[model samples]
Target chain A: MRRWLARVGALTAAAVLIAATAPIIMADDLTVTRGAGDGGVAREREIRDIKSEIHRLEQRVDQLENENGQLKKSNAELKQNADKLQTSTTQQLSEIQSRASAPPSPADFMDAMNRFLGRYRFTLVGGAAGSYIYDRKSNTNTFALDLEPIILWQLSDKLLFEGTIEANLPAGSSADYQLPVADFQYFLNDYAELVMGIFDQPFGDWYEDQSPFWVNRFITAPLPYNVGSLIPPTEVGLQLRGGFQWGEMGQVADYTIWSGNGPGYTNATCGSNTPPSPLPDCSTTTALVGDTLVSDNNIRLNTHSPGFGGRFRVYPLPADSNFGRLELGASTFDGKWLDGFWLTSWGVDFNYFRDNLQARGEWIQTYRQMPQGLGADNRQGWYVQAGYFLTGLQVPLLPSELDQYIDRLEPLIRYSGINQRATVLGNVITTPGIGFTGSPALYAPHAREVAVGLDYWFAPSIVWQNELDLELPRAGGFYSDTGQAVGAYPNDRAFVSQFAVGF
Target chain B: MSRLIKFGMMAALAAIALVPLAPRHARAAEMTPAQQKRQMFRRGAQLWPIYCNTCHNARPGGEFSPTEWNMIIMHMRTQANLPPQDANAILEYLKASR
Candidate 1:
């Protein structure tokens, strides 16, 4: 602006000098003409012409001054505009920094609360399941619904509380509600924690870690971990649990030790041993009372002794390694039956996980002393499963959008077998006045199953699952909706479908 | 001198107990960038057992790049109802470790 003003001032000065000198130069020309003996008429005309020229120069100077004033005004306006723009830019930058440094807004806090706060989380899983089964007598299709609502509260960095509520609708039965787990864990350090309340039986990967509807690949659990498989699923207990980190690996070991209400049995035995082969001669030995059945240990029948259990896990690879994480686990439980007999269960499991692949296998055995002279019931089962993500293989024909959707799809296959030897006692009746003593052999019959399934995850916690199960060798009965034997079936092949969601 | 040492030890224990009780994400407000990064790593470590281990064994951090982690977390956030800020923390942790 200053440079422009300097130029304008120089031009204005030059115009003024020209305007002041033009008339004198014209007058001198007229005088020279007169000295050369010019006419008076011509001199007058020259004078008039000089006056007109001077007037024109003056007018030109005035126009230049007007232009200079306009230029000054425009420069001032431009300067004002520049100042406003700089102020606006500074304010915008300050606003951005303030936003960056500010704490979470009210809306964000509210959203966190709605999503179960930063310290708390809630997940609702399970779904409606339908099944079609082919039995020896007939073919039947059935539907059932199940719900598991899970809530977790992180009280502090070291303290956490979790609860799971389950409601199940069994085929041909009313709905059953259960508090499967409600526990609080207090971290002692990075290595251990104290857990109290009703918790999942920490016997294997299926019981404590991978049993949720959204997590597991298959719709139904294997025989060993399913209902009435003789393996306890949950218990009211106190536990000490922890994991260890070794070297640069993520986690080397995980362990849990717990004590809870011991297991019990019902109608085990009631008669004295006799010398006769049929054992109906009631004169030789003391009478044996039958064991009471207590699948759940909510009410302790034996106050003096509590069930003791433990699980130990070893991870061979780093927990976060991209190749895969492999884990081996062993678990055991020891308790006294309600009939005062001893019971014990033990299991071993292996799990391998990678971004595109997962494989798990488990073997569990349960033993209980017979109330009568019959030998103890030894029941055991083992299952191996594998799931592969189709997208991980990078099939060429798949489009990008299809690939994303397919990435969430996992196809799985499992093979499992259960063997049981506890049917004899159920055939012999010991109580008086009750005439019926039917064999329950079908309840825990021996069988092998090959299952194929697909899990399509809508989200991390939501899945649509469909599976077909083939149980061979014409078992005593088929497993019902609750995974327990109910009606009669020679051989069973079932198609099961479920829609599951979490959170 | 012995008494002073005992008092100092007691105070130190108290601090340890109190420190973890603060909101982990909120505590990052006054921290430097490096400190915040470290805190995110710690938070991700803690969250692995709580959330990831519930369904499946947690994947190792070396399994994916920062970009992959970001995509994976975004997918999980929707499924798990994880807050954006918490998701970012986990993402930062994975990226930093990677």
Candidate 2:
């Protein structure tokens, strides 16, 4: 084993020495070998070629080692970059999971709620009205009841849409439903609005404002504002109206300008003692034309030109002034009446509101040129009303709990009158014992009404209204018995009790 | 009618946008509490001619106290299905005004 190790060691040393001598031997013999004789040159050339080949191999090995070192460094760097990327991705995923598990904030819940409720809003107003009447002339008693349903939708902060449906249900008039108003309003700002659809006339408080049956002291409307009366209480129209503050007391000025389908045609027998007649032979009643009017009373010249009017109201007193709030207003309209007679109407109104006291009044006049050769005549009406709340009296009998149910006990008084005169275009009076028998003549009557009533308010929107009304007429005039016409009468009286509720 | 309506709406918006730039009274923030309340009441009163009064006259707000108004407003809110925000605004106005 020792001899073999020595021999292997000696051989390794000899090979190393030979390898070291090859490069020097190639350098020293290469020049001489090229010039030597054929046999000597062949030997030298062979040795030189071997040394050259060894030198080239050694250089190739050095190049491979450098390449190998670069490859290892590059591998290390790539692994480090891969590890960094993994760590970063893991941390990001952990952060996302942590955030997902956290509880929501109050703002998140509020935001969700806002998004849920952002679309639309709805409102409904409903109630019942009950009435009992006693007529002196007829000596009869009657009772009636009705339901009033009003619905509204607020599409947004700038838009409002509302509707109403009223029916005299208990009187067997449930099927006869009336939609008084279906309106849409767009607010332009604090001072202006655009309103359209079928709505109450913007004339006076009597028609423009919501006069709930539960609020008024009387069961019936005033003489001038009665059904089939002189004024257009409601109409389908578009209105541009608004209120503004002016003067020292923050006095407000409210105005409305509108156009709509004018009132329907009226026949000469409107206020006459003549009873109703069948169509064809009958000139339909021209007074207070509703949505459906007979051909005889459809005298509108054009769709948009049928009617146009405006009203303006101003508060003359400061808001906190000693006199409280006082308002004065005026309204006017011009339109074509039945038989194509040009008609114009004008009115003035006022209202005073103070603590426990309210007073209001209105005066209206209408003029129309008679068709054919008949001259124009003027018809006029007026009413004044006042109410005083007795809650201030603090009656000892009133209970504390009752106070919640009964806000006020008010005594009210009102006087209203109507003077109607229309010239007959032709002698077409068909009813017996009515009108000028032979010829067209002036037919005018003066009707006056005085009512004294009491209002008991169980809640703000619920009340019982009791009233005694006196009807005075001079010349020819029609009267009502328990809300039914009893023909022309000199003097008539009635007692009415009404119970109303508004939800 | 549609064209007229569109024109009217544009004009109205233009007028409104320009109106605030016009000279007016003192700012609401600068006014006293009573004055502020009065202004709000007057502004709120405009809602009456718009919302109510389709058939009859609107009863005066002064007829009831603030507490009474609260009760009435609550009933009306349910009856009329008034939006919460609008109901709140109207109640606040009535309370301050009365």
Candidate 3:
């Protein structure tokens, strides 16, 4: 060990800083056009404080660099002293060596802290993806790509600050764009937390886990996850949540709750029923209306009500050998964007993994409420999917002949459904429907699709995903433009093939 | 203060390395669902090393909510291009820690 220590070299200042503060202390990569409240003064002061802290941290890093070299030597010395102080372990041995006894020493104490220790880390993510699509109905084949990267700084054991930017070229259709999601988090006693900055809108499970491309079997989360993408999943605001576990039906259970921005997407739907654009900009009326904000989308587009919701996911299949992994969950919200809208939802996800096969199924129900005459559209929707893996896999090169030629391969098939009311798409009149009070031009995009997919994972990081899109027959009408003559489903069939790595 | 600084540096490194290893520890133990939910603090603290340990401090029950933590994971997923499942795992880990 001493020989290994002697061969080491001095580490860089950047490396030391990266080590001392958990690398995340300085990796924010987002900048925006918005200014802080009370003008730029607050921002200026904050900048000043950060600069001072950076200096202090750097100095501390330099000192730690010196101490790291001593840790090994110190440990060795302590171990030696402990050895010198001890002669034998058992009573029989101690009796034979009476003079070998030594007083309790702090030698062991120093080493104990070394074991109960933590670590620091910093990560940088930058990626690019090009989408090439050929749609027979639209008679179009298009290719586009997007690039963005993120950096995060873990300041302490319980503090985190992160920054992100989205850069796409040529806007929405062109695949050219840029957006930033930056925030600071303070874990207030573990279960309780406080966060302020741009964040994802939390309507369901899909939106929160929309990336890596490895977790899912498709292009993205369901459209309803963010109200048809009309609303930015990330909003600026503060959120609070905390929950714990208990016993239920002979299994483990979990629950969580949150509050932030709730009424942003309502304005888009409320516009059709209101005079023009009527945002739910009544932050003060949350108690009156009983709405809370879980994610802030901004005042310009928000209905101004806070968003609040709770969730519970439990495992209750009685621990079957190879047939059961089931979880049931429910989340509900009451928010006012244009007029005031409500959503109550519940879902179930089931998984059964046995031997060389896996199966999964899920269903969700969302009940919505609007004003009697203005925002008068009420609706619910859901879907289900199941799949299985055929191949029994093992490493090919580790002295096993059966693994080399095959690598890895599996085929899958699936079908799903959805139903929605036309009012959700920004249709419907004020007196006849629950309308949009913030923006009149707003409308909703509603439809359903059933897709069959084939995916193959050759290596752990290498995969081939291919899917055929089949439209489901389902729709509702609110007005003439949105009421175009059509069948139960209008989405044409399309195929998607994707190759990705690093999750 | 100096000792605290030393602790900060070494602790930061150990925490950083914990990010990847976090998934391994991401499992929130077999506490009752109620304890798991209330273990927000304990779980949050536990999560400090696995999920946030890479770039943030190991403040465990220190900052953020299970939901807020979920949102952050979402942002990082889209912004940093993290895969959906990994994002979910991180979310689950962060949530449990909270």
Off by over 4 Å in 1: A1-138, A266-304, A319-323, A392-406, A423-444, A474-488, B1-54, B57-98
Task: Give a tens-digit lDDT track for model 3, residues A241-295.
Answer: 3322233221333333445555443333222233222223222212211112222
What docking grade does candidate 2 earn? incorrect
Every prediction: chain A TM-score:
0.65, 0.63, 0.56
Poorest 10 consecutive residues by lDDT, candidate 1 chain A: A431-440
**lDDT, candidate 1, residue A361?**
95
User: Of the pair 2 and 3, which is ahead by lDDT?
Assistant: 2
Instruction: List interface RMSDs for the candidates, in order.
Output: 11.0, 9.5, 14.8
- Candidate 1 global lDDT: 0.60
Classified by CAPRI criteria, candidate 1 counts as incorrect
Q: Report the lDDT tens digits of candidate 2 across residue range A63-164.
A: 655666897899999999999999999999999899789976544654565578675256566667777766665554666667778776766666777687
Question: DockQ of each candidate's interface versus the true one?
Answer: 0.08, 0.07, 0.03
Query: Between 1 and 2, whose DockQ is larger?
Result: 1
Best by lDDT: 1
Model 1 TM: 0.61
